[model samples]
Target: MRDCNIIKDLLPLYKEDLLSNESKTFVEEHLKTCPECENLLNEEIEIESKNTKPLDFVERRIKKETRYFTLAVLALIGSILIFIISYLNTPRHIEYDKDLYKVYRNDKIYTVEFADKVSGIDYTDTEDAIYLDAYSTKYDEIFNKRRLRKSLTFRKENLKTVLYQNHESMPNMVIGSGEIHQTLLPRLFLGFYARLSIIGFIGLTLILFLIEKFRKKAISLPIKTLLIGAPLSLFLGIIAIKGFNTATYYPVTDFKYIVLLSLGIYLFFIFISIFKEQKRM
Candidate 1:
C-alpha cells in the first residue's frame, strides 16, 4: 500500500511525461499490477482526448490566434513606449551657449533659463557642485522647437560650482566655479541597480533550479514554473529598458519602461502557462 501511494503520488508527473526514465519505468511496472490506478489514468486520458477533438481544435485555434494577436499587440505597444520614454529620458548638452542660457539669483534661489522645446531636464547635484542638462526627444527637437522661456531653480544651500557638462565627453563649462568641496555621481540614474536586479534574480533562480534538480524535494511544481517564467520576464523587462547599458540619466523614466515591458511579459506568460501542465503538490 505504501508503494502504491508513492506511485500514485507520482502519477501526475508520469502523465505529463515529466518523470526521469528510471521513474517512468518504475511507474509503468506498477501500473501493470495496479488495475485501479491504471483505470484512473485511462479515464483521464480519455477525457483529455475528448478535449482535443475537432471541435476542441477549433476552439484551440481561436485561442491560439487570440494569444498571438494579444502578444503581438503587447510587444508593439511595449516597444513604442520604451522608445518614447527613453527619448524623453535622455539628456542633450545645452552646450553652454552664452546667449541661450542665463543664470540669476534672487534671495538665494538660483534659476537657469531653457528653451520651451526642452520637455524635460536632468541634473547632477554634489555637496558643492551642480550639473544641468536639457531633455527632449530628437523628434521633439526637430518639430517642436518653439523657444519659449523656461527656468529651473536651485536652493541656496544646494548651489555651488555650477557646470553644464557636455555628457561624459568634453570639459564642463563653469557657470559658477565656486570653491570646490566634493564630487559625486548623478543622484538620478539607472547606474548599477538595474544590472544588479537582473543578475540577482537570475542567479537566485539558477540556485533554486539546481537545488531542485539535485536535492530531490526542495520546491514544488508551482515554484519551479515561476522560477522559469517570472525571472525571465523580469530580465526581459530590465533589458527592454536598459538593454545591457550600465546607466541612464533618468532612473524614474527608465522605471516606467520596466513596468510597461513587464506588463507585456506578464501577458505573454499568462498564455504560455496553458502549455505547462501543473502537477499536484
Candidate 2:
C-alpha cells in the first residue's frame, strides 16, 4: 500500500505547481489507491487557494506606496520653482560709491579708467567728496583729456613710484590732481562688482539645488543645473566684475579671470554629484 504520509509531503509542491511531471504522476497514482492520502492532497490544494488572496493584496499595497512617493517628489519641485521666482524678482540695492575716497586713497588699490566716460570724485573743503562726473556730459570732456597724467603713485616716506597705466584697461576716467592720481591705483576697488555678482549667482545656484533635492527625480537635474547655472553665473560674474571695476575705478585682469574660472570648476563637481544620485535610483 502506498504510504499516505509520503504523498502528504509532495502535496504542497504539487499545489504550488512546483512538482516535476514524473513526481506528480507518481503522487497522484498513490493518492487514488489510498483514501487517506487522497483526502490529504485535497486538503493541501484548498489551503494553497486561500494563500493567493493575501499575496495579491500585498502587491497592490506596494504599488500604491510607489505612486505616493512619486507625487511627493513632484510637490517638492513645485515649491522650489516658487522660491526661485520670488528670489529673482526681489530688488537688491547696488551700492556704487559709498566711502568713495577711502578706496581712492588706499595704496593697496588698483585703478582703471574708461576711454568714453569720465568718472571722478570732486573734493570740496566742506562736504564729503561728490561723484561729479557721474552719468553727465562733464564726464566726457574730463575723460577725453589725453594730456592728463594717467598713472598711479605709490609713496613710501621720501620715496615714490609711478606705475604707467593704459586707458584702455582703466575702469573709468578721473579728473584728480597729481596727488589724487598718484593715490588712485592703490586705493581703487579691483573687483567690487564682480564679488557682488558672484554672491548673487551663488544665491541663484542654491535655489536650483533646493529644487533638485525636492524633485528627487534625478533624471537630468544636475546636468541641467550646470548647463543653466554655469553660463548664467559666468555672465553675471563678468557683469559684477565690470561693475566693481567701474565703481572702484579699475580694470579687469588675469586675477579676476582666474576667480571666475575657479567658480566654474566648482560648479562642475556639484553637477557630478547630482548625476551620481540619479544613477543610483
Candidate 3:
C-alpha cells in the first residue's frame, strides 16, 4: 500500500475529480486496502458538507435582502403618490352662495333657509363642527359660488345655531350657520408647516439622497429612516396648513383623516424595512 501522506495529498484532487485517470486508479486501489486513508477521506467529505451549509444560508440571506429592497422601493413610490393625491384633494376653504342662504330671525333660534336651486358647486364635506359668521358687508358676486360663503373666528359661546330649510340637500354642511366660531379640526402648533409641506418633503428626500451619495459606507439605515419620515412630515404639514388662522376658512376636520392614512402607510413601510434589516443582520 502507498504511504498515507501520498494518499492524503491526492485525496483533495480525487474529491474534486481533478486527478489523472492513472493517479485516480492508484488512489482508489490504495483506499480499498487502507482503512486509515478511507476514514481520512470520509472526514474531509463531512467537513466540506458542513461548510456548504453556511454558504446556503448566506445565499438565502441575499435573496431575502433583495426582496426587502424591492418592497421598500415600491413603498417609497406609493408614499409620493399618496402625498400628491392628498394635496390636490384637500379643500382650500369653505364657500357658499350668499343669495341661496336667507337669514330669518325666530324666537331665540335663527333659521337660515338655503335655496334648493343652487347647483354645480363642489363643496367640501362637513365636520362635527364648523365656523359660522353673519357678514353685514355684501361680497361681490362672482361666477364661482364658493367665494360667496363667509367665515368668522370667535369663541364658541358667541356662535349661534342657525337652523336650515331643505336640510336634506345641505345635509350636515358647516356653512349657513349664523356664527363662524364653531371648531372644525383640532388646532396644530406647526400650522405654517402645512403651507410648504410638499416642498419640505421634496427637499428632505433630495438631502438624504445626497448624504447617501457622499458617505463612503452604506447609508441604507439613513435612507430607510428618510423613507419612513416622509409621510409623517407631509401629514404634519397638512394639519399645520389646515389649522393656521386665515380670513377664509380651511377645513381641518374634513381632511384630517388623510393625515392618519399617510401615517399608517409610513408605519407599515417602517416595520417592513426594520424586519428586513434585522433578518439581514
Candidate 4:
C-alpha cells in the first residue's frame, strides 16, 4: 500500500474521495518523500476542478434549454387547438330552402319531356307535383337522330313561373334548375377540407418513407417514430373527422374523402420518420 505505483493507481479515486483509510495513509506517506507524485496529485486536482466546472456549466445550460423548449411546445399546441376550434365553429354561408323556393317562383321554367321529346308550357305541377325527366341530346346527320342522353330529374316546384328575357348567363348555376340548394353547401366545404388534409398527410408520409429507405444506416432519428407519428396522425385524424361530420349530407363523397385523407396522413408520418432519421445521422 505504501508503494508509489499503488498511490498513482489510486490518484483518481483519491481525488474523488473514494480511497480507503489504509490507501489514503499509504499515499500520504509516499507523497512526503516523492515530490514528483505530489506534483502529479496537484495536477490531477487542477484538471478535476476544471473538468467539474465545465460540467456544471453544461448542466445549467441544458436545464435552461429544456425549460425554453417545453414552453415553446406548449405554445405551439395551444395555437393549433385554437385554430381547430375556430375552423370547426366557423359559420358557413348556405342558401336556405326558403330562398330556393323564392328563386324558383320568380324565374322562368322550361319543361322538357324525354319520352314525348316535346318542350311545352302545359308541364305545370298538378296536386302531386309532376316529375320531369330532362335530357341533353346531340344531333347526328348520318343517322338522322339525336344521340347521347344525359338525363336529370326535376320537381315541378323547382320551376319558376315567370319568364325573364336575358342575353347573359345566370349569375348562379342551379343543381336541378336555376335555384340553389342549401344542403350542398356544407357538403362542398367539408369535401374541400377533407381533400386538403388528405393531400398534406400523403405528402408527409411519402417524404418520411423515402428518407427512411435511403438513410436507414446513416443516422438515428431525433425522436421515436411513434412520438412524431402519433401527433401528426391525431392532427390529420381530427381534420378528417370534422370534414366527415360536416359532410354527413353527402355520405358517399364524405366517406371516400375520409379514406383518402387517412391514407395520405399515414404516408406523411412515414416520411416524417425518415426525415428525422436522416437528421439524426
Give the alpha carbon lDDT tens digit for every residue of 48-81 in model 1. Answer: 9987777976778777766655655664566566
Clash totals, every prediction: 0, 16, 7, 12
1 versus 4: better TM-score goes to: 1
Candidate 4, 158-199: lDDT as tens digits: 543222111122223322444522211123455565566557
User: Stretches of candidate 1 above 4 Å error?
Assistant: 1-100, 104-111, 115-117, 123-126, 153-161, 169-182, 187-245, 258-281
> Could you give candidate 2's per-residue lDDT for residues 14-122 as a string of tens digits?
7777999999898878877888877777776687678755687677766755654554455345435533432332222122342222213445543433222223322
| Superposition error at 91 for model 1 (Å) | 4.3
Task: Give the candidates in order of lDDT, highest first.
Answer: 1, 3, 4, 2
- Lowest-sum lDDT 10-residue window in model 4: 132-141
TM-score, one value per model: 0.48, 0.30, 0.41, 0.34
lDDT of each: 0.64, 0.45, 0.53, 0.46
Candidate 4 residue 260 Cα shift, in angstroms, is: 23
Each prediction's RMSD over C-alphas, in Å, is: 16.9, 17.3, 12.1, 17.8
Better lDDT candidate (1, 2): 1
lDDT of 3: 0.53
> After superposition, which runs of candidate 2 have C-alpha atoms over 4 Å from their true positions?
16-23, 54-64, 96-281
Candidate 3 regions exceeding 4 Å error are 1-3, 53-71, 88-240, 243-257, 260-280
* Prediction 2 TM-score vs. true: 0.30
Off by over 4 Å in 4: 1-37, 53-68, 71-73, 76-187, 217-245, 248-281
